[model samples]
Target: MAKRGSRRAAAETQRRRQTSGRRGQERTGWRLWLRRAVLWGGALALLGALFLGLAVAFAARSLPSYGALKATQPGQTIVVRARDGTAIVELGPSPGKWLDSEQIPEVMKDAMISVEDRRYFSHPGVDPIGLARAVYVWVTGERRLQATSTITQQLARNLFLNSNRSLDRKLREGILALALEAKFSKQQILELYLNKVYFGGGAYGIDSASRKFFSHDATELSTAEAAIIAGLVKAPSRFSPTADVDAAVDRANVVLGLMREQGRISASEAAVDPSAVKLKKDVSQNSVRYFTDWALPQLEILLPETFEPIEVWTTLDVGMQQAAATAIKGNVPRGAQGALVSLDRDGAVLAMVGGTDYVATNYNRATDALRQPGSAWKLFVFLAALEAGYTPEDRVKDVPVTIDGWSPRNSGGSYAGEIDVRTAFAYSKNTVAAQLGNEVGFGTVASMARRFGITTPISTYPAMVLGSSETRVIDMTRAFAAVSAGGNSVEPYGIVKVTTTAGDVLYQHEGRNPTRLVPDYVAAGMTDLLQTAVSTGTGRAGQISRPVAGKTGTTSSNKDGWFLGFSSGITTGVWMGRDDAKAVPGLQGGTAPARAFAAYMRYAVKDRPVEEFQTDLQLPEWQLEPDDEYYYGGDPDEYYYVDESGNLVEPQRPGPGQSPQDPFPADGEQPPAYPAPRQPQYPDESGQAASDDFLDRATGARPSPAPVPAPSPRTRTLTPPPQPQQTAAPRPF
Candidate 1:
């Protein structure tokens, strides 16, 4: 009975232990389930936040509505047309006519789709696959090399969004692209993109670019031409055929390969020769850029600043422009630069060639370059003297002259002695000009230049008489135009008429009223002087078939050479120089510059009838005679100083803001003899003796000359042209 009770107790203990182990297993299972639930809840919350952030960012910005697009038209292009109505250049943007999807060539569409976005038709605005690949490459690779934007996305970004690569911008671009896709069909979207995209050389759309690069319409584009235009979408200027033909051709080949790889074209269809698609010779390259560039600034003067399509009828003669370019290019020495400008008597720009190659450098040397006028400036000095009662026959000594211890020497350092103004002017004698400058105060010389339309600053120094002052070719040309126009002040103009597309005339320079800037007699005298220059002086080589008159100028060290002259109808200025201001060895105004001037004028005047420069006044024989009054012009009332050697002398004019002393002699004695030393001597006041201070020449006054008749504006007589003789060889001096 005791053994049976012990066995029963052991069995009971085993059953209780089994029941406790079952309860512990239940608690462990519950803890595991709770942990997993918390993890899943956190993950779902993070994902929800990301989605909410994206939605809020996209919702805050308003996308461009189609209605807004209709209201905001692109800027109207300013089309610059030649005088003959030939389209020269479009200024504001590409001015291609809008075409529908049907008008666009299939090859062009394929080229664009293959290179820009292959899945354009299938993608919903943004390409998910392309975006994913781009993201993966950006995170794992060294370069961010994948293209993520679809055609719709690119159009959206181009039209509505800035080209920012930030996450916020990218999200917005994607969202807006989806909106565009929802609003328009694929055909409509493609047409808009093709019409609005930029394709270099100031061209805007496909059709304009087709004409710009291939000289045809978009539908007329060949497979290779289509590829060239399609490749320009990446970087228009870099792949433009006119800018870089080789690069453009290479880029087009890449487009062809892309088309073939995408199955848009067969292998045979993609095998078009890029070389055979000959690019249209850029009409801008045909010497039209020079005219357009010169006239661009005048737009502000011609019309309002608003961008509305308008036509600018210019004064540019394409024939003369070509002639000018050829003359300058052919005659300019190698490594040296040349600029030539031609204008009508009314200051209408006829032809302008700024440099050898306008493409290589857009720097317009003809209008912008400032250079020394050299002895060519003597024309104005003599003009001032003529107005101041000195004749061309009046003699000025070619001997050395010293003014305030500053002595001026002739070109060869040898004097021609006493010579008439006509002969001195013909040879461009430096000493004689300096003496004349002193005779009529340097202030008067500067004033004369101002009257002739030289806007550059003129120094009062004696050396300025030798063209030491800086001047521009255009300004000097306008000044010469006054001589060509018979002394009328000509304001240079380029635009003849500006009309809106609506046919309303906005501006018209019908013609300038005749504003006389110089007396008829003075103009006549100047004509004679310049005629002599072409006939027998430094500018002998500048003479054309008909009568021509002008002056030649060469600065020190051959730094600047110039030939500025005019025929009956046109005035042209040619300048040759090194841009760095370095000396061009053996260069002179009468050589390269004269040759260019002659060549251009010969062609420029080919169509015009021969005419003479009109002037009524006769040049006095005494005007061409050598006299001493040409060197010492002073107020008749001003007293003359007598030196210790009994010689009459004129006092140098005082500088600005200084008063003059009494004119009477202290001893009240008569003045000494006139016609002092042929060479002027400026002895220091301290070094001169007291006898040099007398006023004596007044007692020898001659009878006053007869008053000349006032010139009639209606009377214009054509002087007989001087017979052409053997041209004088330009002196080396």
Candidate 2:
């Protein structure tokens, strides 16, 4: 019994010791875990505090400086317009502040507040309500409405930020907003924002933007239009009329709704103008500046020292030019660009606007584009036929023909089985012109075009017959002018006479000898057909109080539209097409451009004197070249005989042993005939010397011929009595 009690006591003691040991270990582990948690928690608190302090410091230190309020200067440009005054687009004295609360149209101010900042006057640099709304969008990952922007914040972004949006950028924007407020007054900030913001295309600032977007002055804007400008501030590219039209309309509608909401405008007032107003077109380098662009490059040569600021006086009538610009802009529809070139009989460009706006783009549709003449080119084809002895009474078959794998179809899927050549030309019939081109030989036509000063490369394909060869507006107008000049190819001189700013004549465009390109009778016949085109055919829209000749073109697929015509002393061509090379929905040459040509003619010739085509008068003698079409074993004498000067009158003398009826080229080369021996490259000593500077710049070629005998002395007199004595002495001998 004693031994059992001892073992039990020992076991109990061991259990007590083990339990105490486990309790001690458990307490130690719990204490160590608490210490670790405390250390980590303290470190996190210190890091967060440091981050907060840094963010605050960064925000305070990064505030905008006064220097940033200044707009950065880029290259300045001076635009010299045709007939129109110069349009200066550049930083001028920074204009102090572009927007004056007093000067700003009330509608523009209301539009801004209604579209961009509803509570602008009541808010700080940053709008709490706007920030909260933006946060909600950020949190939900939803797209924000485009019309929500604080004016101050927008100025901050425009002045400092790139176009990308992100969390970092947003934070920076908020900081910049505060900085901008500290640097500028609310009015100053608002004004800067207005002037610095871009409104679609490349228009910068409110003043320029006003002129560019509306075609009227900023002060001329109606309430609705003012709101439209204000709406563009939220998203200039989106609300720009030219860039994103639908988005622009939608944004504009949003602004209208907001204006109504703010009680700044009545519902009726807001409804007066849709977000997208009917817009007038812009004048561009291609169109209105037609002569400017061509002359600018040469101006430097003419006025080497002071050319930087010379005012070019042009023949452009501002009102007529404006009408043409407006008509082309509105006529091309959505998919195409339009161009027009109007000239006087002297080849003075009256109205030339290349594109809708030069500010929106530099692509001059007038001077830069090269398009197939389509049926407009048919005039050249028929003219070639007329030169080849085919009369207007000649019959031409309008049948399907494949020449070198090229086939031309009559427009609108209709064909006149047999038609008079004159009627075919007047109507712009495709098949007949094509057949005529083939019959005359493409080379002959090409050579004739060259003589007419057409520099664009002409192709030999059958499409060339139907006006498929690409040509420029300037070239087209000039080539047609050759016909207007009565069968003579006149050099297209842009400058009549260049003078120094001081009025000293530097260079003059003397009336050079007109190159007789065709027989006067042949040209007269072609001119008669063209006259018919104006009165009763495709060019009827362009008819004026006087006789007219014109042609219409609708390219395959309606990709291009053209209206080209000639009056007594003027030739004009209007082209419509897309910058992207896409076809417009329903535009055709005979529609808008034809109407525009007609409208322009209404005023362009209003005050000008009346004149008739050269065809009505008697002409000089001319010789007919052998018809190229007959070279392939056909009759060579099929053509009519015309004198070398393109005169339709009979020759003074017939060739030896030939009937007076034979009117082919007089046997061989006659003196003074073209292909006449060119003057020797070098001049005789008696010729005048070129200026040393000019001589130095000239390359290996010799200088142009020197001035002939100095103008005859003013004091020189003649004696008639001396002439009789010389004849008497000769009789005595």
Candidate 3:
């Protein structure tokens, strides 16, 4: 009986324990369900906040409802102008939609609807049915169709949501769609969508895309063209004219099928093979890489010290920019690089190209390159000689010659024998310039170059006459420009105006903007001399129909080639070479680069009337005896020789202006002439000695004698190009 009673009690205890355990398990299950509910609620809240933020950003652009009622927003079209105030290209407002529904065609409506969202007309900005379908496919199939965002949602994404694909982000995207629906109408959303979508090719909107792809207006699209534009909406890069055409055709055909299905076009119309659409565009947008890169720095300086996204009012002309870039690229020899810059009379940057193919690299060789100017430095040589006594018509022997033990010669070894100053300058004959430098004093040449704005650290080396010193293209360009402007040197500025986006005029360039570096007559004479170059000289290829004047230079082994010229309308500069300073074999500045300059200016200044260079009003007869080289510029040493007494023994006293004589003794000694020949550049070492005879009687100016007796015909002197900047910033615009 006791055993039976114990079993019953144990059984009862076991039954009670089992029942309590089941109740505890049920409570834990309920707790888990409650925690999950809280988590999902928090996630939903976070999604809502994210969407709210996106909605606010989109609204900042404009209220959709307000935009729907208006035709267009103010200041939407940005026009790029030439330095002369001619419109080169217009930017903004593409897709046949002028920021308004009134300008949109019915076909455009269908094209956009077929491409972006078929149900856009039926819903508020968010399409719940579409999202539901997307979710169903995602869950039930291996291939997940992307989220079907409505046009409003896409705009919301474009203006606010960055490219993030997290699940939380999708949920937030959904919420933003709802907000956008309440804020904007379908029409307004469509307008914004058409105007803001990227169309690749560096184009920002439909208008730019229209000009780029078809070279036509967005309003003039055929059914085929419309289909093509519609296809690009999905991904501009994939269907752009510059991209793979087969892929673009396939995409366009898909868009056509959608158009047919939407009843926007007939099946027959859709039957037109998209594969047959001409995809190749002959037009090219010359991306002036150097100009844009240079513009960035100028924009920085033009803006306030603070950071605000302000539009930079620049002087770059789109057409001219295209022309200049095309000029450089089309003419640059293979394996070589070139850069070009166009300037207006006021020294405003008109159009600029830093490299031939801007997309290929970013080396701004135009303004940043520091190359020896080669023979272009002859301009300054003439300026110094003319100031001393030499005239353009004066005769100078172009035979082999040296100065102070260094020799210089023309590129071709053969000489014109004896040529007038004009022919010698035009031909870039080395010996004549070297002789001229010696006769006038290397100091005079160097000093004149500095005054003309040459900022490069200068030494009075005999080789400067051959452009042996380093100079940036900017200074080289400006040096030539000063000659065009009659000696008044002005700084080149890309920014014409600085203003807040609200149109507050912060800076305006006014006044003469003058820096009197070279005498007016000196500059005028130099320009006159340069005209000979463009008309029939080495720069003949640069001749525009208008009055054009310029120079061409080729460094040793064609390492550097240069063309700097001017017309009544613009002054331009171009340089070509290798980035690594490697030799560009057999290239001449006159052949390819100068032709490029002429070609560009034709299109760039088509609208402006060609103007001729003005006369030098300041100093007449600046070159003195405008006839011959005899009495006016005879060497003083021709009649006088060094005497035993150590007198200069020259006919005239040394000009107070001459270079300080080397203190070392004259016979068999070292002197301070630049570029003491490591390798002699003369054609015949013995022959150049004969040409030095004319300088013997030495009546010109001389300082005390130094080591290294009178220069042999081999030694040459150089004149640096004008410097770029020398003072505070001048107001541009």
Candidate 4:
């Protein structure tokens, strides 16, 4: 029994020993695995740190120097002021005064923080939580959550980076934001952002925005006004009070809601009435920027290039500019644009409204767009005739005449057999104008146009007499100003004086000596015709309280409408049309354009002394004499030649060796003698036609008429003496 017990005990001890050895091996294997894991983790952490350092260093290289960030000077500023000394616009970087931290209103700061960055104060330049949320939203397409950009990041982007949507730019922006946070206090960064953000309408910074929208200093901004300013940071022009007050107020309400939610303002404080926010009276009349834009280039040319700030006193009349803008916007049709330019007798631009809304389009139509002037171009035609010693009472036959097979008919397809030049001009009779152009010679007409300051190309085609040539509003206004100045030349100028901010004069406009473009008697004769036009004819819609003279123009299919007129030394031109030159049914210069002119003139001339145009002129009487050689002589009433179809015919001239009796002229001379009288084209119900009105004759669809054979050597003696050359003076505008 003792021997068996000893043997069992020894087996039990062996089993125990084996089990203990297995447990020890298992623990050693676990220790070895743990040591390998620790080594791998350390190597991965070091690699991650190195990568982060390299990325940060590369982004920092593109950042602006620290000194540049601290500098407060905005390179060169140009402050344009109206003649009355009110600041009209500012050009260049950081135009307005920068406000310090204490100068910024607490309300402005809170409103900006609530809307732009709710966690602006809590984040350390970069918010990992926000970044994760942004990534999740991007990956999951969760549109409800917008990507957030903290204020510090926004400041970094504005100061140091271009607006690019690349990953590299984002990295640089983040790194720069962090550097800025390390360098400046939170208050300093906030102040810099407030002073650097754009708020539309040539306004930069909080102070400028406050002054522009409220006509008050930033320190006096109401909570509602502060909200409006803050809302502009996302889209400045879209929410500008001057651009769309209702939209701006709506955005401000959104900002107010954000502020209340963030506990920045009380519910009652957030309930401020939008109506209580009264924008500056002139805030909506920012159309004056068009004039300032035009004048700035001229000012730059007048002075040497330098970094010093300048103040330009321009000739703009604020009241007149407002009146002109109101008239154009109130009268122009929807989907159409209107432009107006007013010049004093000396050609100082007083008011210029380029379009109905400057924010919608900045294209200066008055100075840039070239459009067909229609019958407004007849001013040059009559001026040419007057210079040729023809009086307003001279008679011309208003008949359908074809030049080079191109027929130009009256607006209504009816003709007045015989009419005086005054009546022809007043009625805008196309037939009479065409006949007169044939007699006066297109070369002489072109020269007359240039003398009156038309710098655009003028085609001497026969159709040009009926206002087919394209011209500019400013150029046309200057031409009319010459007549208002009693035949003196006019140069349109906007800048009166340019000076440094410290009051040192850089340039000043002294009046130039007037050069006579036409004789006083000729101007008086033209004035009589224009006055009659406004008082009794197509331009009657342009008549104001006092005596005024102007002409109306409407191109075919109503593509363009124009009214160029003058009153009390102020010559204003209004043009209404589409940029695409599409037809507008029922549109005419005698309607909308004329009404706009009258509306603007009532205000423009209210403060000026009444001035009547000189109508009486001592001139030789003009008598119309029929050419017996070309006409079948009969009663004076029957002197007009007509075709078998009863269409009035143009006299056939002798061509080459053929006599006037030849049925056909030379190869391309005079279109087969009026092939079919060109079935007088009339506008359809929609006022659109397939014919190209302005360049129909010039188009190669029909053969061009050969030039008139040089005056026969035998008849040279009958020609009158050539007129003396007119002087070429620099245009004043």
Candidate 5:
């Protein structure tokens, strides 16, 4: 029984051991499975966290840099104003002032927030809920929908991004919006958005919108006005009051409803009739159209890439400009046209009239027209003569002469009989001028013209001495201005200073010290002669109450007429002619051009105190000593000597079949062997003799002229001749 029990016990014990072993194996397997499940869950969690981290890094790399985000800037308007700060015209696409958050009204702010982004103050530049709603609407509704871009996102788009409907653009906008929120406070972001938002009619910013819609400042805006401005942001042109008043009013009503719903405005304010809102009339047309058109290109040149509003203080004098235009229109004939340019001694254009009416013709004749100046160009020739050691009191014969197969006749068909140089210039005698031009080299006259700011190319022909060359009226005006400035060369300019609205100067005219082109004695002498002409000579019509001096010019067949004159305070030039260069009957420089000049000057100098021209009346002493050894040292017998009587005697004529040799050149062209006379290098304020004072300082060498005949007291009188076409005075005063 024990063995059996033992055997049974062993078997039972073995079975029990087996059963316990089986239970232990089962428990171990369950524990292993639990361990494997926990490990797998932990591994999956780690993988997800790693993937999320990598995604975040990639997104951060794709974002704009911090510096780029800080570089956001909006376009600014360029405002050109008169000297007194009166706005003349505004240039550029945006016309508005930058308003600070404080300058903006609370009503405006509330209206903008209520309509644009309700949770603007709470959200982080992007509204997730609004975007989700937009997506739901887009999926469910039949109409297309747009994603909600916060004010910050809108500002980013306006400043740095283009408007494009795409996922990539939206991602960038959202990234920029978040970056903006991170960089700036809520108030700063709102202020930037208010200033950068676009309104209709080329207006940007809340202040500009208010001014455009209500004709008032943003700070003065009412709740209704604010609502209307807020509604313009979505589609500025579509909601423009100038384009569609009804549509704009409806849009404003929508904004007012939203404002009322958001508790931004009272019920009474929201209930205001949209049609009763007094919208301002658009003053889009600039008053100073001509001046702005003239100055626009210059502004572009000063700032090639202007992204902000600039303030340009120009040299335009409004009163004088109007007066000039009035004078030109009133005096100019119905069929003919006229142009006038009036400038101060400092080359500031006080007044300019390009045509009779700017609306009739946009062509700016004052700066563009190139016509024959006729006797108006004689100033240069007279200057050349002065440099050649000839005085205004010197005598020259006025006789009909032919040179180079071209014979020039005087208007009267009669000789003045050995007239003085001053009388010849005053009477506009052509023959004497031709003789004088031949006497003094034409090259010298051309040089003097260039010195006086005449940029047109001058011909070497004697006819050119009579103002046959064409030149712009502005250039002629500038040339006369140099003379008025006491021989200082002047470059005509209009712009004075250009600055940003922030007062940062972009460009400023740095006027150079006046540089003298002629000696004071020469200028004074010329002024004296010109005064005589204006007072009693051909240009007598140009006489004003105060002492005035000018020259009259009439081109061939009366195709162009001109008068250039100056006072101590101002210099003006007037030109009259047809665009096609047609001859006008009875047109004379003394008649029409002189009259126009006087008319404009009468108004131009009305307010200014009378100022007299600077004059140094001391005459140059004449000291001539004979020297047989010439500087040219060519033919000693060819040289013609000036006698003590101041008469230029002619040498014996060459025999027949032998070309008559001229001792000195008859044409204005300078001889290569003999160096031409030097002009003033630079002007001094005191009109002192500057560099190479060849004229002011005397030299021992005497003037050795090639033989020329002295003026005869006796000449044949011609019959009364047929009246020729009205032309420039054969002699420019």
Candidate 6:
């Protein structure tokens, strides 16, 4: 038994030795493999490091030198100011008054960091966690290449890089961000970022933005206002309070929530009332930008090109501009746009509203849009007639007439035959205008329009007598300003002077001289007709506290409505129409356009002394002798005329053959006796008819007459004029 145990122990020892040897061999093989694997991994890591280093070098090679990057230059800055020296707008990259770190509100900084970069101060230049998450989101198609740029990185990009999203750009941005961090402290970087970043509407710094939107300094920014401004850094144009206040307020709310979530503010502080955010009164009036934009192009001609900042003193009257804007906003119908231009007798532009909203569109309808003037073109036609020796007392027949395959009829469809020139003009009888156009020749009419300062091309077509030629509101307003200036030609001008910020005059409007476009007698006669139109005829809606001489124009199919009038040394023009020239339902020159003109004129002339128009010509009375058959009701003794407020007023009866006359007649003689009243007649059915076609073809729909409001308590209550009976003949205007 002992011998067997010895043998088994020997075998077991041999087996154990063999197993231990195999185990040792396996351990030695594993260690050899581990060393090879470690060497390969080390080499791969070195290659990657080399590649990364080369990329860094390549991106850094094209970067501006540190000094050059720090020396950033802003673009040309042009400050447009109103006549009163109020800054209207700043054009170009203006680095507004730079606020130091101490001046910047803490709320502003907190809001920006909370919304833009939560880990801004802790990160060197780029946050690894944010970068990784951004990459993951981009790769997984969760967002369109989300930007995880830190505030430092944003400052770097704003200072030295273009906004390109390529990997190379990102690499350059990252490198520049790190360099910026190394060069400047956190507060300095934040200050630079706040001052350099764009806040839209031509504002570049927080100070400028605050002044522009809040009408206050950045030092006075409330918590809500700071949030609003901080949120604009992401999308300035889209979040601009002037462009879209609701959008800006909503974005600010998001910023406020972020501030609260980051413990920068309390939940109660995060709750912001959008109504508390009010844009500056002037800032809210974006219509002023239209004038600024228009005047900007004129600056190039006024001064030599230079990088020095310029201040252009324009003729824009802020009060008048606000009045015009308010008038248009309150009166212009929905789905349509309105434009107004007000000029002094010397042609200084006092106010201009280009469209319904300048933010929605920058198109300057007052200066850029060319639309048919409708019957407002008749001013030129009648002025030509007066120059051709026709007096306001002269008679013209309103019979149906065809000229060059074009037939013209009145807007009322019926005509008052054998009416005096003053009566025909006040009533806007298209037949008489066409007759005058043919009698005086189309060239004479066109020449008269050009003489009055209409710069647009004039067509001499017979239809041109009815204002078929497309013209701009500015040009038409200037033409009327000539009459207001005693027949002197007016060149509409906005810029009074252009100077450097140092007060050196670059340009001044001093050399131009006024040229007499027409004789004072002709102006008087035209004024007589215009006064009649406003006092008792179609433009009664345009009357103000002071006397107004104006004309009403409604284009074919009512696509455009125009009221051009002059009162109290100011000539203003109002136009309402669709941009696409589509007809506005229930629109007419006698309606909204006339009311808007009156509304603006009431405010514009409120402070100015009331001045009466020169009526020296032997003008006939505007009263239309009532037709016995058409006279519906009321006593003949109650014959009335509409006063400035559209109230009916009784006139003093004249002695036999002693009619009312101007105190200063041109010939120093009494005006002619009143002509026999005529009956209203329809177009002759047997008259040779021409195609009733012209520019902006008429829909042959008779326009509804201007609505007369209920009489005031102090005014005489009289019977309103009988409504014109509609006929089948096509309406001409």
In candidate 2 the C-alpha lDDT for residue 334 amounts to: 72
Superior candidate under lDDT, 3 versus 5: 5
TM-score of 2: 0.51
lDDT of candidate 6 over 94-159, digit per residue (tens) = 556878899999998898899889988998777888989888899999887766789888877777
Model 6 stretches astray by more than 4 angstroms: 1-68, 71-73, 90-199, 205-285, 618-733
Native-referenced Cα lDDT, model 6: 0.78
The true-versus-predicted C-alpha distance at residue 304 of model 5, in Å, is: 6.9
Error of 4 at 143 (Å): 32
The clash tally of candidate 4 reads 4
lDDT of 1 by residue, 388-429 (tens): 555555555665546545566666667666667777888888
Order of all candidates by lDDT, from best down to worst? 6, 4, 1, 5, 3, 2
Model 2 over residues 1-733: C-alpha lDDT tens digits?
Answer: 8999999999999999999999999999999999999999999999976875566456647754545555453222333434444432221212223555567777777788777787788776778887788778877878763324588777777766766767677667766776666556777776676667666545666666777767766767787677667778656655776655566667777887888889998878878756448665643323444446555566556554542223444456677777777777766667567788877666676677788765455466677788866677766777777665566655665554444444455655466666676677777776566567666677767777777767889976656655667788878877777787778775554544544346565555556677788767767877878787778877776676787777787776667778888765767789887766567666667777787777777677677677776554232222222112222112323323333563333214446886644323356433122221112111222442332222322322333222222211111000101111000000000
lDDT of 3: 0.66
- Model-by-model lDDT, in order? 0.75, 0.62, 0.66, 0.77, 0.72, 0.78
C-alpha TM-scores of all predictions = 0.62, 0.51, 0.52, 0.58, 0.54, 0.58
Candidate 5 — what's its lDDT?
0.72
| lDDT comparing candidate 2 with the true structure | 0.62
Query: Please, what are the lDDT tens digits per residue for candidate 5 over residues 1-733?
Result: 8788889878888899999999999999999999999999999999976874564455556656644643444555678777677777775555467667688888889989988999998898789889888889889985577887899889778766888899888877777677677766798778878876888655778877777777777888887778778888988767777667787789989999998999988999899876777877755432245566666688667666766768888877777777777777777766888888888888887777888765445577888888889888888888777665555666666666543434556765766766677777888777666656665666777878988888877886767878978899999998888877767787777788888888999898888888889776678768877877898789999988998988989887777888899986699999988888888766778887788888879888888898876654443322011122222233544444434664444434568899754334345443223234222111121432321222111221434343223311211111112222233333332
Error of 1 at 731 (Å): 12
| Alpha-carbon deviation at 672 in model 4, angstroms | 33
Best by lDDT: 6
| Candidate 2 runs further than 4 Å off | 1-294, 307-309, 491-513, 616-733
